[model samples]
Target: MTYQDKVILITGASSGIGKELALLLAAEKARIILSARNEAHLLEVQAQCLSLTPHCHVLPMDITDERQVQEGAASAIAIYGRIDVLINNAGVTQRSKLIDTSPAAIRKLMEVNFFGPMMLTTALLPQFKAQQQGQIVVISSMAGLFGYPWRSGYNAAKHALQGYFETLQTEQPIPGLSTTIICPGRIHTDITYSAITGDGSAYGAMDPGQAHGIPVDVCARKIVKAMRNKKKLVLIARMEKVLLWMKRYFPPLFYFIARKGN
Candidate 1:
């Protein structure tokens, strides 16, 4: 479907895949609403989108905050009277193993990566129902499909996202609403820099795997294509695709290779 004049709300639109999506969608002449905790960065992204299209608004929000999420959902609907799409792209990663990671750290990851998206989606459900049509895109991770080293909380959170959204798809609470779950492997972004450690502190380092992975723009393009197709599920990866196959067909070899992965 054409994006021209479509109202799309994207969370975490300040940078990475979200920023690229905003720019790309803006170029398509879609009305864009950007949301994230960093108002300054949101404004920067808004300015960039404004250069491409006339319809761009910034809604600063911390998804983890239930009150803010409720307000943000209402404000987003008010901006364009109705939202055609909601991209749940805001999330955090974990850099600590299960043995060393604190319970609080795991909870923090859950709050942002799982509960936040669920809350926002729930808040916007009525709006989608009122419109009688909407699209929900969730940016999960390869970790959701399988476990990996040094990412216990991240894995759990993404897995939770998979379960929740997949169930939503099956339930079909909104008749004309559709859900797209995207599993991306090691996209070249600075997500690792904000990764939480065992003590819930930022890892503050770029991951070698992420640095060598698919480009952020490429990832965004694939996501948009999947959304337009109304795809049920999409996997954007290289070797991780093989790893998933191995996990399904040969568990032992998958474990051995996954252990050696970075």
Candidate 2:
């Protein structure tokens, strides 16, 4: 399927993978609707997208806030009449060990990474059902597939996200209503610097591995391809792939690797 004229709404479109995806889809002539908490950054991305496709909208929204999410989707629907695709890319990560992490921090991470997207997807369910066809793309992490060090909270949030959406994909009540979860190992982004710490503050540290991960544009392109193919799940990054392989075929080795690393 082509993206031409498709009205696609992407959260976290202010920067990184979301911004790249917006530009890529815009080039394909899709009606791009951008959402994020950063209005300035959103406007910047909108300008770039509008250069490629005339139908570009910037809707500043914090997905963690349920009200903003609902209102944002309503506003998008008001403009476009229908949404063909919804990309849930807005999320937060954690950098502290589970024990050092504050309860409040875990709750906040869950709110941003899990509940926020879940709420938005539920809000748009009726619209999708009415349209008779829609795609839901979730930006889960490799952490969602396997445990990693100093990120139990982040891992937990992603794991829950995977469970919830994968289940919905299985129970797909209507034909053409699809779900695709994209799990990236590391796509060089600001996520590291902005990752929440044990005390609920930005970690302010960018891991070397993340700083040098696969390019964001490449990741965005792959995700778009997966969405077009309506793939159930896609994983990127060699480390993540290996970990999943071990987890599935060699449980003992998976535990051994996890323990040695984390």
Candidate 3:
């Protein structure tokens, strides 16, 4: 549908998929609220979005910070007193295996990828319940559907997000709220380089698959299309969906191949 007047709040809007999505929505004249930790980058994105529409606002805050999440939610709701859509796009990846991963590193990824988004979603639930209608879109990953080597923590966090949002979709007491989980396999981004390592440091190296992944704008268009359709779950990327089918229907073969993946 047309996002001409829709109030869409997006996390991690400073860069990557979130930034591209913001540009797409802004071109549609949506009232965009861009949230991220980097104030400078957020302002840069805000300027770009404003070139498309005058309804863009910048809300800089780290999703990993609970207090900031609370403040961000309050600030968002205070804008026009409604949030038609909240896109949980803020997340961090991990490049460490379970054996190599530190407990602290795992927790850090969880805080950013799973717990932070949940805190923001929980804080905004009341506003949604009061309004009687809202859409929550989660930008998850293919890893959420199946485990992979050297990404145990990232897999765990995305898996947790899938469970949490899926439960909300099925069990929410309200009648008008709907949750959509979007699983994106890969798109050219800095996520791989920024992923946390075993020692809680950035991996700082891009993966071959990510380097050759789909364009961010193409991924953003697909996401907005799915959002318009109000889909419950969407698996984007051709190769990734095929792999998911194998993982679900041919576990033995999938496992054998996954062991060889990089």
Q: What lDDT does the true structure give each of the candidates? A: 0.95, 0.90, 0.91
**Compared with the true structure, what per-residue lDDT tens digits does model 2 show for residues 1-262?**
7899999999989988999999999999999999999899999998899889989998888898989988987998998899999999998887888889999999999999999999999899889999999999999999998888888888999999999999988899768799999999988988888898999999898788788889888899999999999999999786768888999999999888887663
Q: Write the per-residue lDDT of candidate 3 for residues 8-29, one digit (tens) a residue.
A: 9999998999999999999999
Cα miss at 237, model 2 (Å)?
Answer: 1.5
Query: Deviation in angstroms for 173 in model 2?
Result: 1.9
Poorly placed runs, candidate 3 (over 4 Å):
none
As a whole number from 0 to 100, the lDDT of residue 126 in candidate 1 is 92
Give the winner by lDDT: 1 or 3. Answer: 1
Q: Judging by TM-score against the true structure, name the best candidate.
A: 1
Cα shift from native, residue 63, model 2 (Å) = 0.6
Q: Give residue 60's error in model 1 in angstroms.
A: 0.5
TM-score: model 3 vs. ground truth: 0.97
lDDT of 1: 0.95
Model 3 root mean square deviation, Cα atoms: 1.0
lDDT of 1 by residue, 61-170 (tens): 99999999999999999998999999999999988878999999999999999999999999999999998899999999999999999999989999999999999999
Better of 1 and 2 by lDDT: 1
Worst lDDT 10-window in candidate 3? 235-244
lDDT of 3 at 25: 96
